[model samples]
Target: MSPEAPPDPLDFRPRVALASLSGEADADWARAGSEYAGAAFLGGIALDEPTREAARELVDRDRTEFLPADPVGFVDEQLAALADSPVQAGFNVRTTELEPLHEVGAVCRDRGAILEINAHCRQDEMCAAGAGEVLLRDADRLSELVAAAAETGATVSVKVRAEVPGVDLPAVARRIESAGGDAIHVDAMDSEPVVGDVAAAADLFVIANNEVRDERSVREYLEYGADAVSVGRPSDEPAVLDRVRDATEAWFAGEVEP
Candidate 1:
């Protein structure tokens, strides 16, 4: 059964966040919504297949963005590097087939910014390891991981592909809530072509990404019920975020609010 959705109350207002698409962690963090005066996300979710041959084949390909060698450590250093910025949210660190997430969780908790557990990645290697979408095949275990991380007092948010029959979006959202996740971040599949626009499933606060980079699109997602929206990639042009931020500011200002 699909999980139940969160209630339609407790509205929030978080500024726009730019998903770090720039290759350099420093550059990505540095850009962290400064121009837009909003929020920033560090590191793109890592889709790096552990095997070398597969890794080479997947670089900069598809919806996946692979990471450099040593993902766990990379997430650590990147977190440290971004310490002083207004930016807080960092992308999900893969823990599917990988081992020992305790140390990783500790690092993120220390930084005061929560780490996202990626259950949405569709890349081949991540899938092969029973990570990402593969985890969707087993919801109970996914709930455990989300709950365990939350126990650390470190926020746990799962990024997932849209709910297929077994994936059951509403049920999963409840598991996430039961697991103590502060929010749910979904990268909607086959979302509308408009930039920054999203197709939200329910009332849960959504941090929707992919194909979002402008004002109107942001409004579309908000209309669909996203608490906040994530921007990146195709919208890398400067001011893409500025326009979005302006629109968001205006909306939240009670002027032209969605």
Candidate 2:
């Protein structure tokens, strides 16, 4: 575990965020607009040619699209286009090594944005390459990855999958926090309570994900101790962002308190 600085409050903890949704390109960015989100994610962007090729091959089957251009340039371009975005911008990347990850982090640092490592990708190609959920199998290496990127002076977040076959999610979350990760985004699936449990076990800001379709689900995850909740499929609809806003404001106003 390495030391870390406190997270930026405006980074959107305990609020509604747009998760990294897959498309031909990063559509979430354009679609999100200035709608009412605390933050928006820009990938699942692959770092190397193999990972990129894997994602491209999986497109028809898994709908995973890696960044078509160089990752550093992609981040730069995305950040350039979002110079005036209202919400915090986070770039989600999938890579197995620290060098490329560091490069991407450097881009984030130079551009003044957040870099989120994608350990939550479940695609067969990603898993087969030991680049995604496989990181959960080795906490030390995962922590090292987090630590390495954090050293680049970039805000780092580790996104992991909950309910994995042999992965102890709470332990993973703690390790990420110890490694200086600023946030943990959990694809909690149907087990909402795990979000709270992870929050309790680790000091990192927890972002709950999975099946977040409506206001009810958003409120449920927040009540479960997640500092924030992310929506993917539901976020595709502009009206859904309104619902999330209503639900979040209501939560703060005590109308959605459980």
Candidate 3:
């Protein structure tokens, strides 16, 4: 008899994820396999800084050490360091150009990592350059970015904010799916039902984010159609991570009600 088929790599749910912790650079990479998080999103990298001065400011504001010089290489190193662990590395990149995103996607493919495009940033600097929330107003542009990243032979995911006023979340999900994006990481922001709507509207993976605290929150999102749930501010505490991990395990075992 033939051996059982392996589970899809991209389909692996990141039950507990480390959402781009901005303050400490070293701590971020070190927490990859901390026996808690199944995935780490190394993030908010400026893909196309206008100048070195701007880059410095971005690094300071985002509280990240990554620079434009070798963003992909940085992600590669992070992935390499977690080689012996079950943790998956995903790079969150901010860029307005399709070509650069395509390049980053290729690098992610080569480095065995996932590439997440940033559409969630609300900072003035990012929006002024049409790199973040601006993409929401232009669905065609957002879809183009997804298509370009997808063309790079890597599993591409778009990170978006669900609370963006006037932005149709389901429409955005459809645009990402139609553009061949592998997943939609929604910063749901207390909108569990909207997550379900997105999942219903699109055929891609859904990673729900925002205010996830315990088993109840995890089960709530999962039942609401989130393939996975992400933790942000609460993850700063080790205890919180522990709780989330246990909750995720129970969730997977069907011990937690959906």
Q: Best candidate, lDDT-wise?
A: 2
TM-score quality measure for candidate 2? 0.90
Tell me how far the alpha carbon of residue 160 in candidate 2 is from the true structure, in angstroms, after superposition: 1.3
* Candidate 1: 10-residue stretch with minimal lDDT: 192-201
True-structure lDDT of candidate 1:
0.59
Ranking by lDDT: 2, 3, 1
Clashing pairs in 3: none
The list of candidate 2 runs beyond 4 A from truth reads 1-10, 24-33, 60-64
The residue-by-residue lDDT of candidate 1 on 1-258, one tens digit each, is: 999854221232345665554243333544545566344555544433443334354564643354567766776777776666555545565564333355566766776665577677567765676666777778787877777676665655677666344566666777777767766676776653221222233334467666666778777666666667777664455667677777777767778845
lDDT of 2 at 72: 71
- Each model's TM-score? 0.76, 0.90, 0.87
lDDT of 3 by residue, 39-156 (tens): 7777657666542234476667654445646755665676666666676667787777766787778877776667888888776666878777878888999899899998987888
Instruction: Give the total clashing residue pairs for model 3.
Output: 0
* Candidate 3 global CA lDDT score: 0.75
For candidate 2, lDDT tens digit of each residue in 95-192?
77778888988888776777888888788887777678888988888999899889988888888888888888999998998898889999997677
